[model samples]
Target: EAGVAQSPRYKIIEKRQSVAFWCNPISGHATLYWYQQILGQGPKLLIQFQNNGVVDDSQLPKDRFSAERLKGVDSTLKIQPAKLEDSAVYLCASSSTGQWNNSPLHFGNGTRLTVT
Candidate 1:
């Protein structure tokens, strides 16, 4: 089976600019997620999706970040007016079951973004 795929493995932009990241989750997975990892910190869940509908986004910075899963397969995450503090690795992950289940998450290598 194919793993989650991400593009533009790395990106660099000045503060106040905008950037976008792309992800393609494994097939047949019903749950997908986005996580942000700042250097020296653990990855933090930013949003979760179940079959093209948003399931959780409590940790997402709504004013600066947005994400969408289209038709339950491909997903995109965008940041507007990037902040130096936003420099981090953005990871995409997927599981076969919903949040309540114990299905292990499979993650993409991630897109590393650096805001200068």
Candidate 2:
């Protein structure tokens, strides 16, 4: 029984540069999510995917941020023309079911992004 996995635990780039992060959810998990956590602030849901279809992305910044859960197993998140405000920790989480309220989401350690 393994947990969620994320790569490039830390990243640093100049403002306006592009960055991408990867996530591999637990096996059999049907729900995946990406979140952003600014220092001193709780994580904010950026996107939610059930299998390969998007369930929610209302908070995602469409102008610069994009994410996808391909094949309903792995996911990737990218930020283009990254802004200084985008400096934060990006979290990847997943649940075995779509019952968000009833199922618990397991999270990876997260990728810390720094924009200089």
Candidate 3:
């Protein structure tokens, strides 16, 4: 019954440097999600994956942001040449299939990225 795991907790980077964050979701969960939470705002879904295939990525910024859930397990989110607005908490969550509407997502505290 392991919960979601994230790394670095915090990061500070220049506006043009690239940064990456990692996440390991709960065991036996079939759906994984990545969210960006800016200060004072609710989490916004960046991408979602059902197993190895992407279920939704409509909100992801394609120009300089990318993500993947390799092997249908651990996932990574990368921001290349970061921007000042990219500073936010990157949260990961997972839920068992068929319980999407009933079960709440288990979220990692998140990796707080700061662009200076």
User: All models: lDDT?
Assistant: 0.95, 0.95, 0.91
The digit string of per-residue lDDT tens for model 2 on 32-111 reads 99999999999999999999999999999999999998799999999999999999999999998884567988999999
Cα lDDT of model 2 overall? 0.95
Q: Positional deviation of 27 in candidate 2, in angstroms?
A: 0.6
State, as a TM-score between 0 and 1, how close model 1 is to the true structure.
0.97
- lDDT of candidate model 3 versus the reference: 0.91
After superposition, which runs of candidate 3 have C-alpha atoms over 4 Å from their true positions? 98-102
Give residue 62's lDDT in candidate 3 (0 to 100). Answer: 88
Clashing pairs in 3: none
Clashing residue pairs in candidate 1, if any?
A: none
Cα lDDT of candidate 1 equals 0.95
Residue range with the least summed lDDT across 10 consecutive positions in model 3: 95-104
Supply every candidate's count of residue pairs whose N, Cα or C atoms clash at under 3 angstroms: 0, 0, 0
Residue lDDT tens for model 1, 1-116: 99999988999999999999999999999999999999999999999999999999999999999999878889999999899999999999999998789999999999999999
Between prediction 2 and prediction 3, the one with superior lDDT is 2
